[model samples]
Target: MNKSLITNLVAALLLVAGVLLNNTLLSLVGLFALSGGLTNWLAIHMLFEKVPGLVGSGVIPAQFEAFKNAIKTLMMEQFFTQANIDRFVSGQDSQVHLHLQPVIEKVDLSPSFDKLVDVIMNSSFGSMLSMFGGASALTPLKEPFVLNMKQSLIELTQQESFIELLKNQIDQPNVMAEIRAKSKKLLMPG
Candidate 1:
């Protein structure tokens, strides 16, 4: 269940029980509990945004409802700002290549040659003739194969889907709620 929905459900049950008991003290306690849940609900709202002109001044109604806006701005400044991006771009990170190299440092083609030969033999006769032929076949094809492999690698490296995947993950609501719940638990009593 969503945190807000869980809180609302609990608050409603507490309020109903307090009313049924017909006791003033229990009703007062229920009101406090309801307020606590309402605070959590409101807090979740203000986390991503802020209420306008909610000041941090002396004798003000809510001296720090603006805390949420300040926190949001600080978060953006630290992690989502252009300056941070520029800092990353200017830092030593450009040299930090994290892509994994192929497990086999060199693919030894010698072991696979028999399969290639068999495949060639199974194909048309002209291809088989070309496969068993002299240096003429090997010499011309080697450079093209190397160039094609390098081009394929370069294209793969330039793809941006990995970055997009991380971007999407960071914005998922369930992910955010789990993080929020865990972080809240660290400081709050049950």
Candidate 2:
């Protein structure tokens, strides 16, 4: 049995015993206990059910749309605000640089070297290059090129214009609309 039901039952038994024994104090205590238990039970019930003639009952179902709007507002205004975005970007700067190392390591500079070789092969250096090892001579430069590119990218991200551009893109009206639409779809999920 529910705790409230057990409480009410005990309260009822106390009231009956008080009446039989003619004790006013016991009767009053019983009445208070009964009233408190019943009121708590009724309030809980009102949260889920529409009580007849009772205003604001079944509140969860009644205010579901408002709840969804509140969720969307909280997500967009509080969580995705400009200040929050700036904080996140600032925090990830070092992380971004670290992650770029693997990408730089994976880069293949052979194609670029081949193109350079083709250009040189067609120029005045063509005959002289034929004596040299051609594109294979550029293999030693790959590590330095990758390192320079990575450093350049890290420097680019540190610029104020780069952060400002990111903020502008996130703050765009279309982007906000798309976010709102996706949030609604996630919450409602038809």
Q: lDDT tens string, model 1, 33-143? A: 888888876665555455666432232235344665566556655664554443343334465333423522244444344455455556686465776673344545555
lDDT of 2 at 86: 49
Model 1 scores worst on lDDT over the 10 consecutive residues at: 54-63
lDDT of each: 0.56, 0.73
> How do the residues 69-169 of candidate 2 rate in per-residue lDDT, one tens digit apiece?
88877876786665555445454434422234456557675566567667877898877766777656656876676567666766775677876676667
User: Among these predicted structures, which one has the highest lDDT?
Assistant: 2
Q: Please, what's the RMSD in Å of model 2? A: 9.0
Please give each candidate's TM-score. 0.30, 0.39
Each model's backbone clash number = 0, 0
